[model samples]
Target chain A: MEDNVKKIMHVMRRAPHGSIYTYEGLEMILIMAAYEQDLSIAFIGDGVYALKKNQDTEGISMKGFAKTFMALDGYDVEKLYVDRVSLEERGLTEDDLLVDVELLDSVEIGRRMTEQDVVIHH
Target chain B: MSHRFLATILNSDKVKIGILLKEGPYNHQAADTAYKFAEAAIKKGHTVDAVFLYNDGVINATNLTDPPQDDRNIADRWSKMAKEHGVEILACIAASKRRGITDDIMIDGGSITGLGTLTDIAIRNDRLLTFGD
Candidate 1:
């Protein structure tokens, strides 16, 4: 990786489906991944719910893109960090998530966020 | 002489900012806050490269918007601000297509473009600020 490659971090603080922020944030991430930047995603608060397994959106008539998280690695956007406190608060574990993610404490996530060139919260 | 040198340094430190708005007008305060922030940044001698409208924010660029006589016209405000500052007001093509926003229906200074354009804006600008619901 070049020194000029920006470290961009997208912070997902909302749950999926209730609002369009998380879904649209994913869309933005997918686009930015093509630029070959050092991109990472942080799942905090209700954002941890977005990666939950077996999301059935058929009854809600919304497109189920939960599986899309699994495809991010192919685009070279493999850094998915989850907030450990948030997951425990919601009674969710790594097994409950659809994709593999680095479970880090909030302090660690904050440190990484401070190191980013760009931080976008959704 | 020292004050003049400091002023030059301060002026040279001005950053290029790109704003990403993800909500529509009226329903949220994101558009208003973004507009004010853009205005303030420009007043502070910074360059606002562009305002990228995503998702429901495409409505901010539509020409068909007509607020009440007593209300502030959000689209017109964006158009006026863009014209005055030479700022590019771009709405995501995909988002516009879903929201019935076409080229003909866009405000004078606003245009519909692809997400690639947004990527370029983000990469080129020194700061990328996002405002949404």
Candidate 2:
């Protein structure tokens, strides 16, 4: 634990594959992970769809990076937060997600967000 | 004046901000908003350390850009703003190469740098604000 480890929270609000925002957001996260910052990801709104199980992108010709979410632990980016309401709205639970995450309400997530040094919404 | 008001006015904690622009000019309002935000931050006594252009945002640093006579030239605006404020306008090298943004086409006060620079900007700055679609 370095003294200058800044808490960086990346909030993903967009759905995967619909646009490049989520994919590119993930790319940015991956790059920043190498910096050894205290990084956390929050999936709000359609962002939860990014972690849904069994994402088949073969038909769209797009490279499926959904599995990459599971690899965040390897980069020391283990704090994955999924909005509870968002998951329920989409008729999904923790079991539907491909990776293990802390299912929290928006209030808790908002509090955690304020504690961060930087918050990037995508 | 109230104590809180006086405290706020006397506060010297000016945040060092670094902007990350991921959208291109014209197609999105991200560039325009980021430019305006940077301008406002400078005016408010905050130091805008750098503007790291990534993805399509690297296109905003090209000198060969030609906008309509009535339109505001985004590249020219960024170049002039950076020159005046001493803000480093950096475009990601990989993204630039893919988008045909060579050094010869780089605007004044702008340069092509690697993602490592972006990482440094994010780490060094007090706030790393991102503007995109």
Interface Cα RMSD per model, in Å?
Answer: 1.4, 1.6
Which candidate number has the best DockQ? 1
TM-score of each: 0.94, 0.90
Candidate 1 positional error at A83, Å: 0.2
| Per-residue alpha-carbon lDDT of candidate 2 for residues B1-133, written as tens digits (9 for 90 to 100) | 9999887877668889999999999999999999999999999989999999988999999999899999999999999888899999999887788789999999999999987787788789988999988
Which of the CAPRI classes, incorrect, acceptable, medium or high, describes model 2? acceptable
TM-score of chain A of each: 0.97, 0.96
The runs of at least 3 residues in candidate 2 whose Cα sits more than 4 Å from the true structure, single-residue gaps closed, are A1-3, B1-11
Off by over 4 Å in 1: A1-3, B1-10
Q: Tell me which residue pairs clash in candidate 1.
A: none
Task: Write down the C-alpha DockQ for each prediction.
Answer: 0.59, 0.48
Worst 10 residues of 2 chain B by lDDT: B6-15
Task: For candidate 1, give the lDDT of residue A67.
Answer: 84
Candidate lDDT scores, in order, read 0.92, 0.91
